[model samples]
Target: MAQPTLGIMTLYLSEHSGVEERSYFRKVIAQAEKLGLRAVVFTPVDVDAKNKRIHAYVYDTETGRWSRSWTPFPHLIYDRCRYQDSERFRKFRRFRATYTRLVYLNRPISNKWGMHQFLATSARIRPHLPHTRVYSEHADLTAFMRGRRLVYLKPINGTGGRGILRIERQSGGHYLVQGRDRNRRIVAPKLVSAKQLPLQLAAWNVKDRYLIQQGIPSKLPDGRVHDFRLLIQKNGSGEWEVTGCAGRVGPKMSITSNLHGGGQAVPMTELLRRRFASEEKIEEIRKAVYSLGYAVATEVEGRFGRLCELGIDIAIDPDGHPWLLELNPKPAREVFARIGEKETYEKAISRPLEYALWLYKQHYGTSSSRRRSGAGKSAASSTR
Candidate 1:
C-alpha cells in the first residue's frame, strides 16, 4: 500500500527560479512524512501539460536533502503561491484553469476592497470593519477624510506593507503624511498645507489602484504602531481553530506593523497586558478575538470554498475593541517561532498536514483499503 500524497504548489520568485518560503516548505514536507503522507513541492512552470506529470522538488529524509523528480499529480494540492507581478503568476492562473478537477486544500480569497465589500454583507462581521472606500480620485480621499483624523491609503493588491500611506490631519489645517514605498522602505514623515496635500501624493496614482480606509489609532506611547496577527487553521477534524495570536510592533515612524517591513513580534498576552489595565479585561479581549477569528474564517471559507488556514490582521483600539483589518490566505506561521512559542509553532506546521491526511481518508478510505479499491487511480484520473 502507498501513502496518500500532497502537492505543495508554489511559484518561483525570479527568472533564476528563486523560490520564497523554501525553508517553510521543507518543514512542511518533513512533517508530512511523519504523518504517513508523501509530499512534493512544485510550481506551475514545472508542469508538463502534455505529459500529465510535474517536475517536483522532493525531500529525502535519510539524506536530509532536496532533489527533483517527475511524478503524477497528488491526491490533494496545497496552494501556497502568493501574488506575483510576473509571467509566473499568469502561468499559475492558466494551470488552475486547466486542472479544475484537482482537489485543492485552499482557494484564493478576494483583495482588500473586494473582501471588505463581501464581509460587509454579513451583519455579524460588519461591525468589526472600519469605514473603507475605493480611491477613485483625490476627491474620494478628501471626502472619506472629512471627519476622520487618520486614514490609510493602501494598494488593493499590495502585500508586506508596501505602498501604504498614512495620512493624519493636524491642528491648524495642515496634514501629516508618511508611508512605505513599493519596496517597503519608510517614506519620511512630511507636513504639507491642505492645498498642497494632493500634489504630495500625486506620484502614487491612487485613483484606481488604492483603497481609502479609516485608520484605527494604534500608536503606543513610544510612537511605534502595533497590531495583532491571529492565525486560524483547520485541524485534523476539519474544524477551524485558533492556532495562536502574536502582537507586532512596527519600527519607529513606520505606520504599518508588518514583520516584513521591520516589525517586531511579541506574544499576544504580553502585548495585551501592556495596553490593558486589568487581567479580566485582557481575558475578555482574548475571547472576543477568538470569536472574531472563528467567525471571519467561517465566513471566508463559506464564500471562497474550502480553506485550510487564514492569517487575520486585527487591531485592538484603546477601548479594547477588536477590528478586522485584513486577511491573508497564504499566511506565514513564523510569528509563533519568533515569539518563542515552540509548541504553537510546531502545531501550526503539523495541523495542515493532519487535515490533508484526514481529507484523504474521507475520500479514499484507509490506506490498505484504498490500495485494494484502486483509489489512487481514481485520484490521478480525476485530477488530470
Candidate 2:
C-alpha cells in the first residue's frame, strides 16, 4: 500500500526563494511522515505547468534535511499561502485559476469587509459582530463616528495588524489618531481637530481599500489593549472543534494586539481573571467565546466551502459580552506555543494532518484499494 500525499502550498517570501514558515512546514512534513502520509512544500513558481509536475521541497526523516524533488501534485493540497504584494502573488493567482481541477483541503475566504457582510446575513452570528462599514469618503467616516467614541480604520486585506489606525473622539472637539503603518511601525498618537482629521489620514488612501469598524473597549488596568484568539479545527471525524484559545495583550502605545506587532501571548483564563472579579463571570465569557468560535467556523465553511481550521480574533467587553473582531484563514499557531500550552500547541499542529488522513480515506478509499476517485473532482468543482 502507498502512503497518501499532501502538498502544502505556500509562497516564497523573497526572490531568493525564502519561505516564511519554513520551520513550521518542516514540522508539518515530519508529522505527516509519522502518520503514513507524504508531504511536500511548494509555491506556484515551482510548478512545471507543461509537465504537470512540481519542483517541491521534501523532508528526509533520516537525514533531517530538506531536498528538492520533481513530483506529481498530491492527493490533497493545504493552501498555506499568505498575501504577498509582488509578482509571486500574481503567479499564485494564476496557479489557483489554472489548477481548478486539483483537490484542496481549504479555499480562500473573502476579505474583512466582504466576510463581515456575509456573516451579517446570519441572524445568529450577526450580534456577535462589531459594526463595520467600507470606507469611501469623509462622510462615511463621520457617519460611522456619530455615536461611537472610538473607531478603527483597517486595511481591508491587511494582516498582522499592519496599516491599522485608531481614532478616538475627545471631549473638546479634538480627535486623537494612532496606528501602525504598512511596515508595522508604530505611528505615535497625534491630537487633531475635527477639520484636520481627514488631512491626517489622507496618506492612507482609506477611501476604497479600508474599513471603519466600531472599536471595542479592551483596555486593561495597565493601559494595554487585549483580545482573545480562539482556534477551531476539524477533527479526525470531520467535525468542527475548538482546539484552544489564548489571550493577546498589546504593548504600551500600540492599538492592535498582534504578535507580529510586539504583543504578548497569555493564557485566556489568566487574562479573563484580570478583567472579571468573579470566576462565574469568567466562565460564562469563556463558554460564550467558544460557542461563538464554533458558530462562526460553521457559518463560514457553509458559505465558503470546506475549511480545515480558522483562528478567530474575539473581544470581550466590560459587560462580559464577546464580540467578533476578525477571522484569520492562514493563522499562525505560534501563539499557543508562546503561551506554554504544550498540549494545545501540539494538537494545533497535528489536527489538520489528522483531518487530512480522514479526508484521504473518505475520498481515496482504504490503503488496499486507494486510487484516484471522483471525490476530488466533485470537491474541486464545488469550490469553483
Candidate 3:
C-alpha cells in the first residue's frame, strides 16, 4: 500500500510563567486532528540555527502525552514560543533556530532593537499605514512636533495598548498629555510646555525602541475615540478571508481602545449601522472597510512568506476612512470573542495547521495510509 497522505503538525508551546495561552493552542490542534490531519505540540532538543541540530518532540496518543523523537522529521512546525525570562529567552532563541530549518508560519514581527526596521520599511506599505516615525532621538521628535498639535508616542514592540501616550497642544504654549497608569488606566493627565519636551523625553526615556506618531484623530459621532479589529484568516484553499469584525471604543480618557486599557468591543455590523449609517450607505462602508483590510494584508503578505492570517487594527476618521493601525501576524484569540455574535476564531486559528499540513504533503510526501493500515496490526505496532 502507498503511504498515508497526512503528515504530522507540531506546535512549539513557550512556557508562560503564570499566564495561560494554551486553551487556544489546544483548540487549534483538536480542530486540525478533527479535520483528519496529524497534529501535536513540540519542543526541540538541541537548537542551533547557524549550525543545524535537529531534535523534535512527537506526540503519542496511546500514552496521551508528548515525547521527544529524533528521526522522522515533522512536516510542519508553528513557533508560538514566547520569552518572559532570561532562561526562557535562551530557549526561545534555540527553538526559533530549529524551526527556521523548516518553514516558519510567523516569526517575531518586531521588538525594541529592530522595530524601526518595520517602520523604515513602511514606505512600501505607505498607502496602508498611518503617519509614523521612530522617536529615538529628541531632535526627531522636536522637529515632528513643530506645528503639529496632536501626537502620540508608543513602544515599538508594544502590545495591548501598553506605554501609549497622547499629547495635544494647548493654550499658553503648553501641552496636555495623557498617559496610562501601571494597570493601563489613563488616570493622570500631565500638562507640559513646549520647552519642557526635552525634560519629558528624558523622564520617559525608554531604553528600548519607540515611535512618535501623528495622531489619526479618530472619533465617533459623539466624540468618543474608537477603532476596529478586523480578523483575517486563510481558508483550506489557502486564501486570505475576513473572519469577523468588531468595534473597540477607548476608555473615557484613554487614547488606545485596547482591552488592557479598559476598552470595550461591540459587534461591528450592529454598532456601525445603528450609530452612524443610513440604509443606503451601510453596505458601502462595510465593503470599504473590508477592501482596505485586504489591501493591507496583501501588501504585508508579500514580505512575510506563507502568511496564514492577520489581525488588522484599523481606525476610521470622522469622514469614514479606515486607517491601518497595525497588522499582527500572530493575533491574539481573545479579540475575536468581543464580536459577541459570530465567533470566527476557529476559522482563523485553524489556517496555520491547514497550511502546515499542505506544505508537509508537498515537501515530504505522506505516511498516513501506511500508519493507518498498521494501526491495528503488528508491523505498525512495532514501528510505533
The lDDT for every candidate, in the order shown, is 0.89, 0.89, 0.62
The estimated TM-scores of all candidates read: 0.94, 0.95, 0.76
Runs of candidate 1 exceeding 4 Å displacement: 366-384
- Candidate 3 lDDT: 0.62
Query: Pairs clashing in candidate 2?
Result: none
For 279-339, candidate 2 gives per-residue lDDT tens digits of 9999999999999998998888888988899999999999999999999988898999999
Residue 282 in model 3: lDDT: 60
Quality of model 2 by C-alpha lDDT: 0.89
Clashing pairs for model 1 are none
Write the residue-wise lDDT of candidate 3 on 135-161 in tens digits: 777788778888787887877764667
Compared to the true structure, candidate 3 yields what TM-score? 0.76
Task: Tell me the spans in candidate 3 whose CA falls farther than 4 Å from its real position.
Answer: 1-20, 42-73, 82-87, 107-125, 181-187, 221-224, 366-384
Q: lDDT by residue for model 1 over 1-384, one digit each (tens)?
A: 468989999988786466778999889988998889999999998888888889999988778888999999889999998987789888889988889888888887888999999999999899999999998788898899998999999989857899999999999999999999989999999999889899888966566879999999898889999999999998887778899999999999899999989999999999998888899999999999999999999888777777899999999999999999999999999889999999999999998998888667656686786665454564222221
Candidate 1 local Cα displacement, residue 67, angstroms: 1.4
